[model samples]
Target: MDKIIESFIEDFKTEFNYEKIDKSKLFEHYVNYVLISKIYPDRSSLDKINVGGTRNPGIDGLAIMTNNHLVTSQEEVDYFIQDADLLDVEFNFIQSKTSESFDMGDIMTFIASVKEFYKDGELLFEDDLLNLRDLKNYIYKNSIKMEKSPSLKLYYATTGKWLGDINLTTIINSGIQDLKSLDLFSDVKFIPVDGDKLKSLYREIKNKITKEIIFEKHTILPKMDKVTESYLGILPVTELVKVTSDDDGELIKTIFYDNVRDFQGFNKVNTGIKTTIERKNANDKFVLLNNGITIVAKTLNKVGSAFKISEFQIVNGCQTSHVLHHMKTSLEPSIFVPLKLIVTTDDDTINDIIRATNSQTEVKNEAFEILKPFHKKLEEFYLTFEKDVNKRLYYERRSRQYFGAKAKSEKIIGLSTQIASYIAMFLNEPQSTQRYFGELLNSYSNRLFLDNHSLFPYYTSGLAINVIEELFRENKLNYTSKKFKYHLLLMFRIQVAGAKVPINISGNKDNEKYCTKIMEALWDRENALKIFKSLELKLESVLAETKVLNRQAYLTRAFTEELLPTISNAKKEGKLIYYNFQKGFGFIKVNNSEDETFVHYTELSKVKINEIVPGLELLFDIFQSPKGAQAKNIEKKDIVKKSI
Candidate 1:
């Protein structure tokens, strides 16, 4: 391997904690992450893109993109269909090899697998691949909703250099033609990535973005507080396209503001924009007919007619930019677009500009919620733990914030993930986290992300979810644990602190102490694994007792209601370590204590007395009696026995 590529892999392994994964599999993940970062820089989970395991055939990584969001399940596709219009779709397939050179045979196998994946009633995949296939099928089934044909992108990466052999070129060209003949995709591209190319792509994602554009034809505006500079002008269509596109001519997706709605495809408005630019004489009228684009930048340097801008976002005009980029080749040089550029590092001014400029479109109020001071404070809170490696976490209040900080991609917690974890652990509403973002925000708007809420609990919840995901990646937990991960967060809290949840964790020393305990447990890997193991045992006991085998049932409040009491009892009132049925007396082990209490048959009801058995967990209170400590207020915990 090239020295640069080797160095990148080592960094990748450390950042994602992938030392345990096989070498070949690690390379596949590295390739997938580096390449996909080109299009979607804000991917929250790397495991979702990896589909290369047993029975996967030849493909190593696959990502199905609807609009700009990465879709991993059918439910996500359904969400897009019901909530937002599916304007476009793109399929990204990757096949990586750790070998020094790529072989023709391996290349052909990859091509064949791609074909089989598109065919009906053919080879089936498991786990992530199966979910990707289902999403593909569902997207095609609802193809009518799309304004354009889905695109197909195939990437073959190897550790060796590409010398441009004639035979290999011919083989790749043949594969591209064969895929295009299917008529399923409007365009098909097969990119061969060598070690050198991979290294460059890695640098591209980690590098700070800077672009220069000619801004001569502009009028300067007086800047106010928090505004460095402002400009109102018209940019030529050609110049704007250069700013919106990359070297490969793909849209610069990361430049768009995170809060603004994504491009609405070739809807009535976008179609009009495209049509106006495509017309012979009407092109020059574009500036008058279209709404101007709004740009906000952190730093802007001026040199004559040329301006170098870095760390910029297109706060408005997402639809116009997409349309212009699509019709760039056909646009005339006489065409121009309205442009409003503002330079500011103040987040409040940026959010104010975004909300004001986006009034023409219907953006949900929740979109701007992250821009508030509460989330900003949370982001700052996460930074205070940076000195401790194990306790450090990045809160991503803005899109690509972690990328800008060069933080480990896996260690950065997204806003959505943070909210879900807090709802599950602190709020005890794991089921509600699965609901759509809009509904969840509206339903819990008042209670969540509050200024007065304790920040420790939020960080604790985020860390708990992070630990659960790591456990899954390490195979310490089985597949069944994935569905109930949120539920496990609740159980983890219950095990550390009993069922009585704190009404307001802020300004309460006891609650702070409780959160600190959870943080310590999560910081240590072995201890965290032990806690999850015990929680899983209790989970299995509940499933067996309720006879609820349906996977979806685990997400319901009823299932949680059933599982909570059982686990809480074991935590509040410990196991029955010893029981002498004939003697009518036994010893009970108290939770979080070193001593045991005496239990008598007289404390149990008639029904409970008949069901009494050794090793069964029971909920009871201890009281001082003549003999010392005795068990009272005994109740049964619906949990299986642990051997004494």
Candidate 2:
């Protein structure tokens, strides 16, 4: 072990035989470095993220995030300053202890400390944390005025056994309830990062994006006829609980990273689910009352009666699994949950399954970001963003940099879950306020709920956000009003209506901007009626687009067999102007057009790479790739003699 690990182990050991280890910053560092980093992949909270003091206000650390939906002020037409004292930012509170076990007292102490910070928040030191205190005070002072206010997450980190019970959980629930009753903030969630959870989190961070899991069969279920479908069976709760409560939590974490809803940690509905499982008559109605878990796997093979799944995701039943794990020892041993594990290697199909099944909750969705795997069109659209003032948003493809807690520009133009919700809501539920967004964001387009292209790409939807933000700012709209919220949603709906044959917004560029093409569609009377009366929205457009996208996605199939042409633009006569048979690459010069494009041997017909010499005449279509325009579907053409 490294010196830090060795030192922490010693400190952790001392607590097993005694009341507490000597107060040291080592435990603080361990929780911050290992536990926090593992939980938040962005490592959003570091350096200035921590704010513990002599008499720490129950908070060992924090990450205050500004609301992305803030309306730009008239005073600042372009941007807003990221002063640390920015009001109404989200909060993630951290409280760490170097203790081996936490009893009722410890749990209550943690809650009390959290409540204390909210109630009696004072600047710890006159010099340090002035900015943070100012921000907190601002949130507290103007708590009622905000629409979706700052969220408080009290994270308890300890190198100890989590002594969970009815009383401790009830107290935490009561605290959350009290916070909500007043409507001071958007929401408050409590998370306990005990020693086991911490260790699991650490392991998860060091692993791959996807993880493999084994499920021993309880009984074989009926199978679907689809090729993508798989080993239908019952997964014994007792056996699968091991994966849920693993020291590495890799399976559960990896599965739910992109999940829309999360384990709300001791909510009323979850408690009811727990109650149903633990009741005396539980086994009798367990199968009927309980909605079984949905499992999606990249690849599955039967290991005797057991099934090993690679690149698997538990799209639905996350809360159920969490409840099962939390109340593990108290449950019946013979309990088994029905598993519908689809065994396939398709990435798009897996996302389809996830979006299809994760709709049992009552939580209002923030966005469709979870189904990002299927949003390639948007990913492609974002690349076309011309970096003007209007093209500031980043369609985050890779990192968690989109939702970082930093007050910098990286935080400004990041991928937002809200963006998806807006696109989905406009297309799915434009008129209904009761149901803000559609549950079938993935499935609504097609019954199969596979890869659908009707869903607005991040670039277009993100641009909508920018446009509305700008227009609203220009009109001097308030950020927190019920009317504004509805109008904002309507604005998105209008834009979606216009996109079938998109209209241009700004006077300049003749509607060149893709966002403007979609945005400008809002004003046309005919398009507006088609969208509102006929309810022809983006959802419908996306649903229609999916068929084409699915057919187009079969590029590999096109290479081997007959399929729809992947390239557009009518074939133009071109010369295999320059050829390098040894290198397997050449340049093509169009017959009439002066544009000379590169072509690879692989891009040519499935002939041998050493087929022909230079100056071979060819006909091909020009298509765009990451490396500019390239000649595709090269076919040899015979040179014809003409009267000279």
Candidate 3:
């Protein structure tokens, strides 16, 4: 197969002048169309040439016909020869090309040119040329008779690449159908010639013609050129001047170096300018005398202005109070102003103030100042600002950069939950608010929830809020300023109770009752009551403390100590743990063991507990055992340090 393909490619290269043809591939399309059109007899007229010219208006090319009269151009030969005896024949217009790729625009342009030629006063005939006006008159006189003749057609002939996949037969048939729809042409035909076929036809035609018909050598067409131009204009300058001060010795030296480097290759610098000094005090009072001498002995005067006699002094110093003022008045509007000032002052304090102000204009100066203080408060403020800016920019960029189909769905649920929660909180109705939050949490979990680090916090927080809100609502607990404290205490106790512990409770046993006992002890209840009663007391306590305790502050403190620390420690120890307070249970890996242990906070006794730490040995009675190993007897053991 490879050898055959290679041979085919070699033959293709030698068969045609590939570079000369604008569309070498078009030859394949014409051949495919001609072959396919032969399959349908009803479309046989599609194989005919189209007639169109000024003197001999319909002179496209030969057409496919059963009779010899149909083979000739009607307008040029048969019409005049037959005279009143009109011969009826089917024909099509012929478009000849030797290009590989054909553009739609080129086809449109050809159609437009044809339309313009026909509209001109000329007609193209076979034997004698006819003007467009004569052709129209002939068509008008024989309109009904011409309709009786076979319909006109459009024929395209090319010697380029084929338009099929491989066999060169299945070209898109839409182009053929479009040709038939034309009012002037009744059918369409596409004829393709390969290099061998084209050579054979040329030889055959040359032999058939009695006169030597000159054939021009095919040459590649010129392509369109694209060019772009830009312009820069020189502005007219009235004058050029440089302003400086005697005190700016350092700046002057640096400027001089820069100017020398910039103009090193230049011939010379333009220096035809005048210089002047206008001194003024801070109060805008002129200091120069009529004779340029001090009225009184030169001395420090708070209310008096003084000018020192010096070359290269600041120009228009009275009109310009500062460096910014001087730049605005001196420089052109298009030029950028240099943000530097030179002030000559004898007072050390005044010089210090100017130096400090100058340094502040630099980008690194603010960062240096922030580090200099080294105060915790200031450091925290800087960090906070940095983090806020980063987060704000990240979200802003994210919102602008991406939009997915799921975004609408996510936003709807998120916004609804947020609005509902705010309303519930503001109304101080914990139960209603909790139900709303639960709906929100479930919605989030069901739809957008993914086990990603950034999303997990929101998932957990939503779940926690939902659980607490539901408990408060079910128990009719009213959260007040004083009760807020006990509420947080209860929340913390619940969290600690839920910490990792051995799960020995049987699945068949009443888990609620066991959890109720643990809750009663943790909340310091009167006694171990029913599970429902314990839950009620817990909610009541939280409600009472809400009046005095800051809810957010309490939650944060408790979370940091009781929950976050243990999680952090577990991570540091390379242990994996999963917690779900809404379910009142959590799981932690047993040290050096493949087994995982489940703990129920509802069963733990907070009052009896002391100095609880992870990995510390403890004993608990196994109320029920379903699977795996567990501790049955509940008791505390001495802390043991593990060896590395």
Q: Whose lDDT is greatest here?
A: 1
* Global lDDT scores for all candidate models: 0.79, 0.50, 0.29
lDDT of 3 by residue, 1-644 (tens): 12332243333333221222222233332332332232211111222232222333222333433111222122343332333233233433344454444434434433434444335443334221232224333443554544343454444444444354332332324444444454444444444434344443333212211111111211222331221111111111101122222121111211111010111111111110112222212112111211110001111112111122121122111112222233324434232211222223222322232234334222222112211222222223223323332111111111111122222111111222332332222111222222222233343342222222122122222222333333333343332322232233233323334332222223313333434334334333223123324444554544354443233322232322221222111221112255455675544454455656555655344314333335434433221122332222223443212312
Q: Which model, 2 or 3, shows the larger lDDT? A: 2
Candidate 1: where is the Cα deviation over 4 Å? 121-124, 163-166, 173-183, 257-259, 384-387, 402-407, 427-447, 470-487, 504-514, 536-644
Stretches > 4 Å off in candidate 3: 1-84, 90-92, 101-104, 111-137, 146-150, 165-179, 182-186, 193-196, 203-644
Residue 198 CA displacement from its true place in model 1, Å:
1.3
| RMSD values, in order shown | 8.3, 22.9, 37.3
lDDT of 3 at 324: 24
Better of 1 and 3 by TM-score: 1
Check candidate 1 and list the clashing pairs. Answer: none
Candidate 2 C-alpha lDDT tens digits along 48-73: 35556565646677655443211212
Residue 224 in model 1: shift from native, Å? Answer: 3.0
How many pairs of residues collide in each model?
0, 3, 80
Worst 10 residues of 3 by lDDT: 289-298
Supply the global lDDT for candidate 3. 0.29
> What TM-score, to 2 decimals, does candidate 3 have?
0.19
- Candidate 1 lDDT over 1-644, as tens digits, reads 77789899998888787767777878998999998887776555466688886677689989888767777655556666765666479999999998778789988888988988898884657555765785688889999988778999999999998888888889988998999898899889888888888988887676766889998789999968999999999988788888888877888887884646877677778889888876778877889999988988889999988988888899898888888898877877678899998999887888889889988778777777787888888888888888888888889888776665558866888887888898888777886665545456766888788778878888889889888888886778876567688989988887776555555546888778888888888999899999899999988887877755444455466676667666645334777788888887888888788978888888766236657766767777554332456666577765323322
